[model samples]
Target: MSTPSYALRDSMTMLRRNLKHARRYPSMTISIVAMPILMMLLFVYVLGGALGSGIGLPNGADDRSGYINYLAPGIILMAATSGAVATAVSVCTDMTEGIINRFRTMPISRGSVLTGHVVGSVVQTMVSLTLVIAVALAIGFRPHATPLDWIAAIGLLALLTFALTWLAAAMGLVARTVESASNAPMPLTFLPFLGSAFVPPESMPAGIRWFAEYQPFTPINETVRGLLTGTPIGNSGLAALAWCVGLALAGYGWARIAFRRHAKR
Candidate 1:
């Protein structure tokens, strides 16, 4: 039998276990899954008009797509970020309750545990994101880009979500409790609001504008929006990729190290 084959086998096995857990806690799963849906409705229908008008987007939009397009990426980010919190809490609980300890004694590969959960969280976040997009359709939001644009937009957001899941895994392993674990993603979650997530960062106060300008989320948000709208990335896509790759590597390194240390201990 090939050795690398065993790794794939172990990953699948671990994934099955995680899916079972998700099935058992429908409420936890739904809460994790539905946040994007709820927020999309709340922000797009209820708040989009006033919010869009305030943005000074042109007096007559070619269509009523202003805020929903702006809000779509933010909702996607919010959806992905919210699901990551569940990842932390789930891992923290396993660690605290010694479920992870029990798993360690089993025959599974060590990375399988965290890696499995990361995959599940990414899949879950994507589901939430799909719901948000569906709601966007109902609200009459249309992408200016072609089919390729939709593909790229989804692909970029999915990559970003995976990167975030790895970082969230680090929090899950090291945090002492559920609350602490969930807190790790909070700062990143708040990052978008400061950037062009809701309103354009240029409209902010001078001090706030300075902070939003260089913050990593600005480029990422701009990159996602550009994909949806067919707007040019204008030199920022490279910066966005650098941020995503950097954070992903850092988070994965920290999380991997933490997992190994915990197993040894």
Candidate 2:
């Protein structure tokens, strides 16, 4: 087999290993899926009424149903980010536990180790997304999207997941311990809250409003909200695409460098 074939095979093997580990210890995946769902329930049931009134929903539909349509996209974005911690922790565990040194002695592809982590994380994130969306629907979040809109929304989410998982993998590579790795991505999990996730950026004060408007997750959330809820995407689609691509490249480069630096020790 050629080099690329070997890399692909090794990556697949690593992905299987990661998935098996996730299955054996289901706590991480369950937490990743649970946080978003619980947040959705909290917002929809607890604060949906008051927050709904302020979001400027059409036809004065500022109730639980109306609020859910606006809130579901952001919660879904959170779900994507929630998987990052798992990726980081898993990678760091392998690093600290000396499995990486064992892999170094084998003939497997060098990049496959990281590739497996990334691919497995993306797979796990997508599953979490599915569950979140299901719960959103169950909770009266109605979207006016067409088939194409659904496709585009899901694609954008997958791209965001891919980008974040790579960044998390890099964080894991650089962290000295599993606990630190888990904490490293905490800001990412909460970043959507600073954006237009829960409320419009227009409602925020001066400084935070500006940040809520320009932040990466803001545009991404807007694009997803527009696609799913028919909220007029404007230029958000382009911005979201740009951010995803840029982040993916940056994370990939960072992870490779960190891996090489660690391999030297």
Candidate 3:
């Protein structure tokens, strides 16, 4: 009989293994962190003034500082997404390389193997998020969030990371190749751009505006902005929470089913 304590112990051991693998091949982590940072620099330095003015900021025509505040949350959201690809790739690599089959022959909890990948990916995502936020703070982004607000914002990001990591795990399991896994989560990384990440939904065209208003990232971005920058969340908070919970549950179910099917095969 597998006890909860034994499962936790097994999961932790698997977590250490995944962490070691990450340390051995750090190019993925570097790329994941570098992309958002580059995007931040591009938007803040190159296009900030024009975009800021387009958004109707008071001094946006001349100053890029105001745009940084608006763009910071989205970039952080990007940081959350950037790791999904890495997670999917790593999970798929393990599956294709026959390690998952080897694990099946071991005397460990079945769920612990996936748990390790999910938890390790979440940790990596949070670390990347911290780096992005640090860069944001260094580069003229100023958030006026209170302590509680900061806590809520971090919690939301963690929840988002957890949800996405699980989904990526499922994608990894379903993917037939490592290359396919790498590409599967590309849409997730770009979802924020189509939403209100860079501009308000009002600025987009009719069809895009509808999508930007209704997509999951827009509300999540809005809730983060409200928490960090004092923007009005209104009903977006509830919507964001709903989306996070729904995705997390769906992803968990999907990953479990995929893992079982693969185990049987």
Q: Estimate each model's TM-score.
A: 0.92, 0.98, 0.97
Candidate 3 CA-lDDT value: 0.93
lDDT top scorer: 2
**What are the per-residue Cα lDDT tens digits for candidate 1 across 21-57?**
8888767668865766787787777878787877765
* Residue 56 accuracy (lDDT) in model 1: 68
lDDT (10s digit) by residue, model 2, range 1-265: 8999999999999999999999999999999999999999999899999888867776455887788988999999999899999999999999999999999999999999999999999999999999999999988988889999999999999999999999999999999889899999999999999999898888889999999899899999999999998888899999999999999999999999999999999
What's the true lDDT of residue 256 in model 2? 98
Q: What is the C-alpha lDDT profile of model 3 across 184-257, one tens digit per residue?
A: 99999999999988888888899999999999999999999989998899999999999999999999999999
Stretches of candidate 3 off by over 4 Å are 58-62
Write down the lDDT that model 1 would get. Answer: 0.79
True-vs-predicted CA distance for residue 37, candidate 3, Å: 0.4
Candidate 2, position 11, lDDT: 99
Q: Could you say which candidate leads in TM-score?
A: 2
